[model samples]
Target: MAKLALLVATFALAFLVVNASIYRSGHSSCERQIRQEDNLRHCQKYLEEECSDSPYNRPGRYLDSCCQQLENLERECRCEGLQHAVRQQLEEGEWEREEARELFQVAKTILRKCPNFEEPRRCEMQSRRWF
Candidate 1:
């Protein structure tokens, strides 16, 4: 009877260990996903800030960096990130309404220049549908 009780206790401990590991693995993965989405948001915000900093100037260097950051995101977010960044910039109220419009146009041009971006298509849709 003692041997049987020991075997049951051992089985319970093994079961708890397996469940604990699985829970930790799943929890970490969930955290990673959240962090990735947060990264995407922050990247877009930074891109807008960068663009706003150098408006009316050549953007060859920093634009590349911003596009690269967005490109690193999941395939779904690359272009959407640009749009979000532009809108976010406008919402920040740093630029006048007319200036915001100009920035939107500039963003469209940047979208065209960025490699792997669909260009013009989504940009036009943004103008028609969004603003």
Candidate 2:
């Protein structure tokens, strides 16, 4: 009986350690997701407020504001997050198909304009749906 109890206790302890590690890793990942979402929101807001209609029409001025918003973000994270965010917006009916397509184009253009921005292949594939 004592040996069985000891075994049970050992299993419980191991289980707890494993659970704690999993929870900690998940929590950190959640935090990172939230941060990326916030950054994407900020970038969208900046584009809406600062960029003129047909920003590609004036690449120089567009680059100034757009690059400022995007420069601080991790390039891969920013691209992936933006693609997800835009897809969510489309799914949620916040944007019409054409609007989402245009937005994706503008985002791609902005990323290209930003110095040292490495365009992620995933973003390209995801955003290519409209094209």
Candidate 3:
């Protein structure tokens, strides 16, 4: 009887630990989503405010360069947001490893296209660290 009780206790503890880990994983996913959302929003705001006003609104070399950079930044932010969403799905056990890996590769591709935007990257990194 004592051994049975010990087994039950051990099982209960293991269950709680697994549950807690899953819960934390989900929470982290949500937090990462929020962070990515905020960064993407900021990038959008910058494009709207800065690029919209630039003479590049027409078609010229300067405008082309600025627009290209702006587009790259926007794409990077968007990819990070997508990665967070994919991670949430992974945490929920709804996504396979291949899908999650593909999504991560997409995000990495986006990140590779642009130089690091320090402040935004820092926020995104911190939020994803919980995983």
- Which TM-score value belongs to model 2? 0.45
Give the higher-TM-score candidate: 1 or 2.
Answer: 1
Best by lDDT: 1
CA shift of 74, model 2, Å: 3.0
Score candidate 3 by lDDT. Answer: 0.45
Candidate 2 lDDT, tens digit per residue, 12-55? 99999999999888656644764644645544543443333544
- Provide the lowest-lDDT 10-residue window in model 1: 119-128
List, residue by residue over 17-131, the lDDT tens digit for candidate 3. 9999998886666555556454344333322333233454432323233323434444334444534544553454443445445434433433333454433332232234333
Instruction: Please give the TM-score that candidate 3 achieves against the real structure.
Output: 0.31
Give all TM-scores, in the order shown: 0.47, 0.45, 0.31
Give the Å shift of residue 36 in candidate 2. 5.5
Model 2 misplacement above 4 A? 1-37, 46-69, 88-94, 118-122, 125-131
Alpha carbon RMSD to native, model 1: 10.7
The weakest ten consecutive residues by lDDT in model 3 span 43-52
Backbone collision count in every prediction? Answer: 0, 0, 0
Error of 3 at 131 (Å): 32
Model 1 gets an lDDT of: 0.59
- Candidate 1 regions off by >4 Å? 1-58, 116-122, 125-131
